[model samples]
Target: MMLSVIIKRTFVPGGFPIKYIDEIFKAIDLLNVDSKYVPREGQENLMLDIGEAMQGEAVLMAEAGVGIGKSFAYLIPGLIRSKRLKKPLIVSSSSIQLTEQLVGDIEAVSQILSTNFTYVVGKGRTNYLCYARYKSGNKHKDLTDILTLQEEWKTGFIKPMEKKKWCVDNCLFNQCEYRNSCDFYNMRQNLKPRYTSSVDCIIVNHNLLVEDLKKKVKLHQPGLIQEGHSIVLDEAHKFEDIVRDAFNIKINIKMVKRMERAIKDLEFDLGLNLKTMRLLTEFLEDFNRELIKIYAIEGKYILGNRLDIKELMSMKFKDMNLLLAKFNTMKSELRYLDFKDSKEKVYDELDEMIGTIIDYFESIGPEVSVYWAIYEKIFDVNGLALCSAPKEINKIIYELLFENQKSIILTSATLGGNVPINSAINQNRAYYEYQTQALGLPESTIYSTPQKSPYNYEENTLVYLPSMDIDVREDSMSNDIANEIIQLANIMDGRTLILFTSKKQMESVYGGMLLRKDTFTWKLLKQEDNGSVNRLREEFSSQKAVLLSTGAFWEGINIKGPELSCLIVVKLPYPVPDPVIKYKASTNPLVHEAEMMIKLKQGTGRLIRSEMDLGIIAILDHRIKAKKYILQSLPFRNVTEEISVVKGFVENKMAQYLSEQR
Candidate 1:
């Protein structure tokens, strides 16, 4: 089929004007005239696939490999659609960094295409400065500095101000004295469809997008982004987890303390000694005693069979009901009293908190939700929380996002991990099926052929698996991995990123390295030893260093050239068994292995970031040797099980890098 015919059929049948499709083609052709334009076949194919999905108003899942210019692929079609439809195109990503990067990419795309479009980046209420809180006698130095710098700032997103102390938690909305001047309020107002006729695109992180959907569902209000808009989910693999987190409800010790403080403040202001205050105090003491007994082992545990819901209702819900009745009585009393508006707002806030807790407990059941208790030490403070997340978030996602939108496009590089270059059928069909079931996409959802990365990974990258047979579950695995890292670090001249699945393992390996630090010429850095990850990355990037890190470093840290030449995988990135994973495993036994493949792909992708980049990856886990599927999922097939082969490969890459430096 001709490409133009495919474009026409895809868009015209679905109500898009043929002229707009023609314009898109012309704009794409214009790129050839520009000296900076490099024509990539993969990028063009993905762009057309997204365009078809948008015009057809269908759901699409696409996997575009690294360096495929995915942001441009989606943005080209998204911009055209928004312009023609005169409706905002909503683009969501997993991180604030990615969201900001998309904004920059959109600006560049607009310039390349010679099109003008207005867009706004939507963030959570907490990210922006709350004028109401600032004006309410907050004399904190950080707050003052942020306010002083407001003119220089574009979004008023001050990271230095403590969120809990200055965010819009207890906001007064229209009643606030600074509502007209509030940065958060003004930004939200500007995001509304009725007010934002000029805004062609709305960029937001996944959390804010889900929160907007929640607001529409629960509050019956127009969301931060317009409903039924064409949406693109960048880094779409993380969307399911983000939706689960946004919808999960929890009540922690801090919440209980806040309720206590609010009630006491109300009593002092209104001069009314209500019986609800005494009941709340009694409930707090009883709840603490019960938590102390239940949390004998400090971690998350399923609450139903282990700590029977019926028993929980008898102990906590009964008192909660009594407290609810007392609060209801207090609400009636406050209506009759001549209290200030702020005090009345406080009373309503407390009432809602108690009501939400009661509703959460009432809704807890095996079929509808997974209830769990969390007991963990955070920043040296032992905390307890009762939480519940909807077990079938697939249904929630379908109803809230997929069912109502004009079109939905989900795209990522590691969507199913290194789909084969040119298979007649998608070799990763089972993986895509798993994602569809997990995300609740329609049966007819379109799946784009995975666009392979154009980089020369075959010559530039090697996957090294050590022949050692140390079990990762055993205590000795950390030392074994540390020894392997020591050898690889010396071979690569200390340009290594050692990744771990467990923080404890990382610390143990760091300790092992510290003992032999005197022998190495380059600096050895641990993630926690540095004040922050950014600082650690800065030092690692600017000098010859070996970094020991876990978590966020596995992905999203991009360093081209010799600064990050070798990557080490200490273990496969398997998810720890938590309440959520436990429930998922009950339904799909391969959930753990599936998660590890995606993360393993991400970690391996950290090396060979660009075509000029040359590096080697070492997988220290012996378990990967047993799983042939995992090795197949990675980008490069230059595999070796011998340590000597790894040393030789690293030496060649180091030589190439030094030659280029001259």
Candidate 2:
């Protein structure tokens, strides 16, 4: 039974009902009346494809290039589907910033389409302030100030309060006196099916979505997100890493100390002579000491091979089993004692935590998971942690998401790998092959041909690869890169962003620039030296200054106009050869280069943010020249190896910019 026949409507070639396509076209026409909206062919095509996928209950992987207006394209279809089906649509993104942006886009789209559907922004439990924790503590001054302002805050999500010790997970849930007024509790209630009929869309970060799936799939519980909902994963390139992190198990000193505290609290409350509890605490202390002996270094180290696991188990397993027996004995005693409900819950939670740790330890092996040990300082307090993460998350992703959801759409600007520019041979599948395999989507998953950005890259951007003969490993590399940056920044008058893969290298180059400060007229700013990333970006936008940064600045940054005319890449962002990378490399030797190409595309994307924007992207590392696939991955068409060409482009663009200002 074809969907078009079942619906008894004329259908488009892509399987979208003709009426739905007409409605989308009408909405776009209405939107185009606004001065800010430009009707893009690619955006319309993407919207139709997404609508077709939703109607067919299929998985879709779309690669929408930057400036293709991807947000509006997906939002139009997502909102229409939710309204038509009378079910909620879930949108998951990788970061808080992007989630917020999507919420704004959804609001704007709903107004234009006149759908008038309700939506809610969903974040993790920790993201919201637990009213019980707020009322229970003498807060730090910084926390106190934020809480004061939270009175007027509608979301109750103070960014600074995230990951703090006294929050939702640490608070009493329904038992708390503040339950009625609790923001976290109320938000949870809003997601229930009874309350969700009016809610057409739910926007959340990837972590919260994964947590919901885990609850539904593993715990036989109603999920935080309602079942049978279609999901749209924006920034889908980052989904794999987020899922891996969500599933990994860790046993840190803090966790053990919390268990000890719970035991002591229970003993006091129950007024029981729990000698075994005392011995359990002592055994935990001994276990920490043993871990410290093995993981003496203050850094991350991979724990490989079954022999290492056997040795650790031999030293600690006997004591752990003895404590487990004692804990079970204590649990039996608890059945006879009339304890408070809260105390009973705490005892059960502690039991589960300990049991999970034991199970995780038993499961440690190279074939199933990757084990690692970390000895680091948290808030100046030294702590040791043993962690285990799955070797691959593809199967889990498929089972939890693709298999269960009615429809799922994974879209990102860099979702696809290198597809040669202007190639016509199965470009759709070839472009998405890496991501489809990496994410474990079905073989029949629909892959949209990559949507091209409307921005004129050939006329507005230049790809500059300096002919400098310097390796990243050389001691003189920082100085040499600094010298090249000085020349380029001088030509652009310091509207430049110098991106580095290494903090040590960035600092060295910053130092070099300081020594030669008089050689250039622009003010120099380094990340963390002046202020936060946002503050530094704001300052750079307001002045002709060069900013040196790494990490977050590599992607999800938008700087338009003359303030950012040049971008300098210190080196290709190759994945650091950690245990995870090593494992991935063992399975696929080309994964490293593939990752580098994706990151290189992201970094270069920071340059031309709009049609009016003109910039030059300079790759200072000579290594990029060897990776021929990079040219195909990047968006720019104008390539040059000479500094003179960069100067010419900068001068012409500057002249054009000044004339436009006049």
Candidate 3:
């Protein structure tokens, strides 16, 4: 069958590739799992629609509710296509934590389908040990951390250091002389061999993928290896921020000091001779002197306002270019110095140290904007150079994804508001107003696209809000909201998820709530308990008690059965004031205004993870009442049962809502 041809036949209801489907059903059949695999009514058609998207070259913007299995909806088809077309499927997630979960799920599904596929995680170059650096550690100063970690691994004081500890500049690939028996390098090398085998699916985070697209554009080109290739972007809502960060450049004083310190360490501490040592020292001294001079002239002023680093640097354009040329020359020269068995070892260290500075200087030009920062005594060094990639993030997305005609599946629990995809574009400016002005990107020029969520909200789940007047925001003068919660606890009993917008509110309510002591025991759990989400969910289910937490508790939590019959959203989570938000809000009026809506939706989404999961959402914010703006954007405004509170019978109203629940 041609990859472009869509099949007319509707597949069976049972999933084809995923093994967890059986386990999912088994849990439901045995009543071990609280939620069932119920896609919202007719939205099952979305699965078919997505199947068509995977079969051809098209972009899908699916906006479904929290309960619908959006990940499975896409993965099952991707796996089947991989088998039929003999192509490699690569899936990228938004975060490391989410990446881990999807990897596990893919493994389970692959086993169940009886398919032979190899999975390899693609990370940046920095994640492996630099065999080149190990050959000549005598050239660099900070071998303390690396040497101690290696010693720990040898004595089993510490396990093998994960990829998180390594960087591309420091990584020594298979060429490392110690590849035969080195623990750290050997383990990583063995993790993913070259894709000579049928490695059908590759998984990555959106940030990593987008970063690769911007930083390593040639590496991500489709059909490079002739394996049937496709990209699945999970949690697609976060693509904008990832794109933004990937395109933008941040050069702060902190980086300069680290390089300066490394150079100083190589010279004074390591007591080693480097071919580029004199050149680097001379350059550093020159750069340091120039920075001190600039700082002295513009000490009291802010970074960009007083001295535009780009503008000042450009004034000496020819000299700077010559300096960079010489730095590169010195870099190439270091590679040829022969010091014997380990004489060439300093080449990697010297190359890395010099390259760090060269990268910073070369990155600054007409296409780059530079900023200067003044740090206190942390370093005797004056203001440091900060340079950023001049291109807008949307431009990078257009160049890499849209311009390439690659099919993209963008899915997120929170992508767009009532406004279409067009509105979401550059809406981040409202949150990043100041930075935009500081970096100088036009606020009006960016484009925002809107599409519905891919999850099925109606059949999969309904948004529930228990009507109440007790606002958690009220302190001494108003009645404590806990009084109302204590009453609701009595009716629904202990199986409730009490979600709070802040820890301050949760503690207050928990303190005021009435406990049954024996018949209905209540246990309070906060998000800061140093427990994993799964562990907390397990605790909530086993104890059949109320689990109270702030923001993280709202979304990314799945619970069903008698253990969690109620979800209490004590308050609407709104974005608090911060430097980033403040900066953006100063530049964009629309985004600045709608910050509350974005945060509220993200917070409310915590409950009703699936169709079988039922719960109550009680918003304690008075802003929703006075503004009327917040009310219109709330999910399921019509179906959510509302109760007006007038007198002070918080308990009676709570009793009525709890009694109505199944």
Candidate 4:
């Protein structure tokens, strides 16, 4: 491995530490030669490029198709680099499932190497239950629920910061009452100094990385730029949109009401002073009333192009200070409470919630960001957010992410965005090109490549683009899509996934299907409508079911063989014209179009997870015929104008799989 990497690392200018990568992957026994051990042609190549990418001051953008051993292609290089350089290497992914898989795979690979490396799964602190806080506060029923990594609140016993070494806080571990029993704090105390500070790698989801970057920006710390540290983004394509979401500071009504409810409940149950809770509640109510009034007028409309942070700061000066002061006073009052008192935890959380709200209020003053308010009736959510829409993420990336870095590698199966966040049309013409530039790194610091999947798509897949006679431009489109899906599922014998652009539309289609439930032999499962994607995935993989989903179902799902045979694209994934999309499209239409293209690609990519799996993609939208860019990455083996032909293709694939099993 070392010899191969050294020979191929001519792309980047640096003395390659070829030995480290060899040490990391040498024990990975691919020679086991089992059903899953088929070595991909692009895997070794990706590893070589990653090795060069990790050698020194360089940025590499590589796209490897599914089943390309992408995780280790970068992981082995990153681990070796982190170990050799004695700097932290961050491997960030878009989803928690991927992050957890990397964490586990890193350990397995290290064991194979006959070596040990310290690594922590970096997530938002709120995902872990603060043991001290949990024991001290009211035992809310919500605490009993199992928490997925996506949750933001730091409460309950669910997933209690399992690694004690990574749980270090500012407190002296020995003096803290909960130290011995505190899973998170204790872990951090021992491991942070013993490991994390010197640890080789940190596995984190994109959200946490973005949040940390946002904090770093606000604090003005020299960001991710230690001498030896480097970075790798597994699903790098999602970074821009993830960053956009992270940078936005939203104050939703649901959160405000939750705060009020927390205060009121604790005040009654813990015997806390009613005076303080009342005061807080009154202020919150006033805030909610103002938001509701605005929402009543402009349902989901953006307030303005930009908010003057100076004006917001001055506008709420006295009220803001009073609220902060009150929370501070409440926090101080906890000192007088008994150490064992549960009321202490309640007030502590209350104070933190208040502080978080204040932080949002303060986020707007920055010149690089845009602030706006939006009112929407959906989920009854409405609030003010510090939005950095349609702007200079590339500048931030170059200045903050790349400075003082050794290597940066970005990879994703679908890297579809084209318009630059802040680039002019004269500078770059395509979204992907703009995306490559928007990272703002100097040309000298970057090296790039693309990889095609080893899959025989021409032999294994069919793409159906049938002309629809039904009028789909009207409100009845949802019903039309539902009927087509019903017909397709019956023809294919009930293994289909229908991807929708809007949840409302998905629900409407699902409802339409329900109206004639007896017409089909398969079960229909909708994302969120029937539990989460995890649950839906299990149900679908285990049985013959037609899964109707949007958003989350497009990617990060695998249903091999006969369990999944068809994918239906309800639309071309045009993002709902939300404030963020509206603002972005206004500046550059390509920005919005690129996002839709990326989503369309992701939706299409859901089919054929395995090289042996066969599936058909039925694109229902006629508009896709005009949007040729959506088909740029896809190579369809068969493109037909008939639904029955696609259905026959699917049925044949399923029968073939069954015969192979026999």
Candidate 5:
């Protein structure tokens, strides 16, 4: 097959002493060929090249444009390397949803492709259900809280899918009776665990990868990664900023309230007597007081009185250590009525409860440093936790690649520009190093990355920039933007998708448009009340809806087919001074600016997922003309080209492009 020829040449290049091109081809041909499951030529070629590149211990950045089957492009190489090299493949993505999707997709595709590869998925230690907490109900109040939460989850009010990854520290993974039946553990076993099961290619997020890297360095142990494995970062661009956030620390009052409420609920559920209830209430008050004191010492941005927030937090945590000892001692000394096993169950549960609280304190104590700061709105005197990450992601790449000598590949749809941690791939390396030393690296090195798109970008895409000079006096800029969308929508009819920077703006535009009231019929969908992006995309594809959304809508959304032929950008999606951004900006300007850049790129990447998937993208912001930075390489060249396509669509030349397609 054409694929075998390419794969053979890749592994056994000319002039190599160990060339095995002929033998390799024959061996691979022994595998049954399922014509229907064979990848397209473009995908096969790219996968073969990526596999060859990794075999040399070279890190490759494959920029597979949206929907070019990127997951498979990398998966084939990862699976092949895992089996051939006898190492585990760790695939990390930017989101939990993608992590779950990767696991499922890999399993589903493997069956069809006849690749008998085993796989496993793991999250942070907190994700599992704590057996000790489950049985003891006395110690960890959070278990009761989660049960209450599960009730709400069943009603579809809150999704616990993401939260299921972090349970508590008291969980004993090896001893759990459910280990064999657990969904996560079962998935791990399915990966075909061999005698050397120490976590081969672990699927992790940028946040977790960065966290582990920090831990590895702090612990001064490179041996932590000695397990036979390589790393594959799926959405690599996010590596930079995620490392930054993962290193810094912050705590919110909402979490404290959640803890307090859970404690009270546990008290009631356990049916404690008035005396015991009083003692528990007093204990919570003490816990609250101690938490505040700790926050004062740790959460502050600056240190004062010779004790920085970190030191103060450390002292406070030590005090908490003492308090837990005293609390346990008192519980043993005071005798209460021993009733039926149910009452005894509640009493024993409290012991487990103390263990849970102690676990949180211990986990935070070593991994996070305490800081003292004022948290607006939530707490007047909030103590925070913080951790400073390594200066560069190269430290991580170094451990994953050089120290481990395992194959690593980084791929993303938008890796070239400043991309958000949640959506696009970000560069974690410092700018000065990138500017000075990056140029010297090999084309296969960290500096010189590869572009893996399926189409000629300049020819296939044109960026359209509409005039942003709106009269500030007229409350009609939104109206005008809506009108423009309507005009473009008519041009493409049912095949247009309009993305708003804000839901309020989306509402305003949709409300202002009058054409859709008559024979100008088209499906109009807006992201109302926090709907899942996957569900929205499903609806958009099935019913060609003009989907309107706020923040999450712009990135991580995929829509194709005749339903979404055009995308309208209402404005340059500069983030508002939202609480979280504002909070971070108040303390660190550079980090905030980096975050804004990342967000902007993510917003623009919503259109033109693949080479064959064509669409007109219009940016209704005059900022392109006024601000020179908007024209810079920040948003990728596709943004510039897509603007031209939007202009062409409105100018009646869309017909010409259609004829070309025909």
Candidate 6:
């Protein structure tokens, strides 16, 4: 099975051996500054292991403690490898914060190594500014504000992509009339598509990297990763989600609505009696219910009746595409006349909807993939859409990403160890390894290590469980969790991070705490109330704020100060039986349980970010005890059931934190 995938899979033999020990030690020493920088032996060893692993062309599956400097550890190796080989190293992170952190770290490490590494920040189709759309100016107030504001710059660089309706596939590039003056045109040439550049390092979020991976695999497009380049996935714990997202082809509700509006115009002009469009719309609406069923269990390999498209085409109506095609042709003609201004809304709607409908047809044909469609009628999200993915994600990653690559580094603070915790916990770890096993390189081709955090957890942190042993399933459980949080907030008195599994639960407790009026003298910021996660993180870091957020906020927002002295766990972070988890869990409950523990560890990893910072982890839910294997997931050295004394412990820490300030 030869793939046209490789433009450059050939590695330079004996280009550079892993003999950079002195250089590594010296770089670590230089980075280990007295000004808020403490060098740890764990970090140094990890960096050495990573450098050797890259030199050996091995997959280094490593887990480091919270303060092990994992970013610098892997990054130093990657930068050195790229510099040594004269080839770029691709680094992918899961979160924006981590990406930003890596960029900053690269700057600092560049000083240590005294090597100028040219790295490209890969922002896929969404992030780039589109010059065609800006000129179209389809009644958007922001577009107007951008045009007026952008006149001051050499190019209207500030007027980037449309945040709501970004269509990267349809970009005209050099073909547009304003191509010379276009922001996107200049950016595409100057900023991005740097595979041909001498600089071999590129940094991207998991989503962008996965998208590029898909482009190479499915479309055979030579994207960011080229010949002889290696990839290091930092925050590698989020690989499963990346795997899911890479193959996820979603047909959104907005696309359907646009198609509907376009159909109305097509009927007005051509009068084709778009009964097929209405039927397609109904199919989308019903598709939502069908998706929920599949998501709750295992994914649907084939869904919504075997004869779905067959029955639809036989309904004495034209095909859906034919109707949309006619509308687009009529739109072009309307532009020639004066009616384009009057029908600009319809014209733009037709363009957006046409692209979306085509995307749906291409993805949801149900001939080659497994898929599900989701629908939500809410204030923020309203519409129905279908999502599709290939059946084997691990296999694809292994063959495409690892098999031909020289070296791959997978590092994260919370990548659960391969060591079996218990029978049940081991099952989840096995499942995790199984999903990642698709990389399929020889055992000798990869390296694996688990580096413990150097922080003094026993002295700096307490894992406090409720003394009352309240059941998580009870109807009054919300009140119990909220009550504990309110008291803990007042006692901690500086800042707190409360992790929740769901927004509904967070809302219920958030509203309940506000009703108490004396929950604390400090302010409570809900994730929903904050316009952005970055804003929420910034506010929480600045004030005595209790930040409430869910899954996405689990790992990245690192608040490492005495002010962040307490972490409250509202519930055991379990895998909600979403289709992927449900199917995997059906075969092995241990895998599901292990997944929960990994998430729990990620939340707890937030506390005691440094040895000097002391804090307490209060688990409101008693489920952690019920599942004895769950204890294996917890990173805390001292677990206490006595919730009464936790108040005193946190109070004394808070006093000390405040006194140090005085």
Clashes of each: 0, 0, 41, 10, 57, 7
lDDT tens digits by residue: candidate 1, 495-599: 899998877678788888888887688789887621445547778988888998887788887888888988998888898776687788788666777777778
Ranking of models by TM-score: 1, 2, 6, 4, 5, 3
For model 5, what is the C-alpha lDDT against the true structure? 0.51
Per-residue lDDT tens digits for candidate 4, residues 488-576, read 88876777888876666777788999998989877788776324456567778777788888656887776777678888887777666
User: Which ranges in model 1 have alpha carbons more than 4 Å from their true place?
Assistant: 1-12, 129-144, 147-168, 172-183, 224-228, 268-342, 375-382, 417-429, 529-531, 658-662
Pick the TM-score winner: 1
Q: What pairs collide in candidate 1?
A: none
> What C-alpha lDDT, on a 0 to 100 scale, does residue 639 get in candidate 2?
91
User: Comparing candidate 1 with candidate 5, which one achieves the higher TM-score?
Assistant: 1
Candidate 4 pairs with clashing backbones: 164-187, 164-188, 165-187, 165-188, 167-188, 168-188, 394-438, 418-431, 418-432, 419-431
Model 2 Cα shift for residue 564 (angstroms): 1.8
Candidate 3 has what TM-score? 0.59
lDDT measured at residue 401 in model 6 versus the true structure, 0 to 100: 75
Clashes of 4: 10
**Which residue pairs show backbone clashes in model 2?**
none
Candidate 6 has which clashing residue pairs, if any? 8-227, 59-446, 88-200, 295-579, 398-439, 428-590, 428-591
Residue lDDT tens for model 2, 561-630: 8888889998888987766767777875557876777787788889888889888898877876886777
Candidates' TM-scores? 0.86, 0.85, 0.59, 0.75, 0.60, 0.78
Tell me which of candidates 4 and 5 scores higher on lDDT: 4
User: Model 6: per-residue lDDT, tens digit, 467-521?
Assistant: 7877765546777777888877787774789998876678777778878866468
Better of 2 and 3 by TM-score: 2
The RMSD (Cα, Å) of candidate 2 is 5.4
lDDT of 3 by residue, 1-662 (tens): 42222234333332234333333333223322224234332233344555555554455555545555556656666666666666666687765556666777676556555555566665434333443454455355455766665554333233222322332354455556655645445434433325523666777666556655664454554322232356676766556656755654444444445544544543422333342344444444555566666566434323222233444566756765776786677667555644445424444565665666577567666543323333332223333434344334445566666555444565555544542223343554333332233222332222112223433344333343445555556655123566555555555566667777555556556655534334345675654433455556677778647777765565555554456665666666654443334434454544443555555666666555544444445565554566565655555443343433211222443344334434
Point out the worst 10-residue segment of candidate 4 by lDDT: 156-165
